[model samples]
Target: MYWTNYHGHSNYCDGTHLLEEYIKCAISQNVKAYGFSSHAPLPFLTNWAMPYEHLVLYFKEISELKQKYAGKIQIYTGLEQDYVADFNLIHKEWIDLPQLDYIVGSVHFVDRFEDGRYWEIDNTTEVFKEGLQGIFNGDVSQAIQRYYALTREMVQEQKPPIVGHLDKIKIHNRHEHFFDESASWYQEAIEQTLQTIAQSNAIVEINTRGVYKKKSKETYPSHWIIKRMYELDIPVTINSDAHHPEEVTREFITTAQVLKDIGYKTLRVLWNDQWQDFSFDEKGMDLK
Candidate 1:
């Protein structure tokens, strides 16, 4: 474990720990670099995000920590930019701002309605099947189509450096009862999404947050999606989405082993506006 972890959180957002706590945890874990990616401040985004008012403070804290631990470890600052079409209009302004090391582009809200409000969308068969049936009044297929369309739009428009947890909304559907993964329409949507990601040259993350939640058997993107990604040769990175110190590198080794089982030899890491491959150690992937 050379100690390079890019997905972590702090008191600035929903994370339970402070920035310093996570840094101390990284030092104890012997990690070389730890990146903090709290939920980005979205002006019009719903109440679930860190307010824009805290941006300066967020930077201040990160800067202070960076100075304090300069030689002991590497600390990078970032945000998990939520992929909303309207939000993209000012995306570059935010991405280009000061003190930002990188970003993890994620789509937590599938659609935003009038009044600039959004609802939680579960892109799975079971939840969406029922929710769509009720919310859209029995037009479940249309909802499913819209969900995929939204996903594709995010990939095309945002073109993030890394796609966060490709199939995150499916976390709780381990029994496979939600939507039919075998269904032609669903399968096509997934295939198209993967192709778009590969074409975008974006690194896909094997997020283990859901696994820690105990809601799913596999990490984000699931085995089905991961297998297809392997076939397509799309680049990948591992993230814990940790909100606390102890959770900083949770399940990283297991996730690495899983990737190894699927024939992945290296993982992507960001540096100088590009992603490069780093060899995995399997049993010793996180020895730091």
Candidate 2:
């Protein structure tokens, strides 16, 4: 396929593959480009993040892979930086690092009022239902309000090259609890978020991490979000959010076809400090 993946994980983080193995997966799929946007070194987030000590070797290995695989496949060095409550305290210096070809800024935790701490809230109905207990001591709507606020801050402050899974909060709540899917408030929150992204000139990745997780057949942002993106004329890209080689460019043809059906002619690729659109063919990935 003439597609490029911008979000993927490697053994450096919580992923299961090494940089080289991931590359082989991409080449087998015949993807035009592959990017290693593994979770960046988060000193505070020790559980699921890469360590700062590995930063030197991280770049070294990817740089070597990039050179060795040049012309065979376009490789990018990138990171998925989380939007912590105290952004400055955790990310400022790390983002300034030299090897990062791009960054996918994401918000995975929602502020919880139970212990006055941030909790990992993924919008699964069970989790959302349980999460309600800690959100302002059972204020579900308030939780949504604050989650949207964090989304705004992620866009405004981080100014990430791409917004990772804009509506990822709904990943777990698909068929159970609908987050006002037909409500004006929900629509407005999304519209305002899209306006901010468009204004910033950033891309929103169609992350397929959930698909592999069996959470849904959809990616982050889902079908509703993708359709809305078409209305706003926002730019988009596809990422497996791969943690293993088998996931490299996983469901890429399906994702690309879905985008094409929704009026997207191409996906955005970052190169030389700007986005370049790569056109798609109608017959899907030739893989010849």
lDDT of each: 0.75, 0.77
Instruction: Please name the candidate that would achieve the greatest lDDT relative to the true structure.
Output: 2
The digit string of per-residue lDDT tens for model 2 on 1-288 reads 455678888889988977899898888876667788878876454566888888789999999998899878788888998887765667777677788888889887776445555577763466676777756567755776677788788888888888988877766565666466567877777778888777877889988777777777677777877888878888888878888888877776677778888889877786434577766654333221
Please write out the lDDT profile of model 1 over residues 164-186, one tens digit for every residue.
Answer: 87876665356555566677877
For model 2, the superposed segments whose C-alpha errors exceed 4 Å read 112-117, 123-130, 271-274, 282-288
What candidate 1 gets wrong by more than 4 Å, as runs, is 45-47, 113-116, 122-135, 138-141, 172-176, 271-274, 283-288
C-alpha TM-scores of all predictions: 0.87, 0.89
Residue pairs of candidate 2 with colliding backbone atoms: 124-172, 124-173
Overall local distance difference test of candidate 1: 0.75
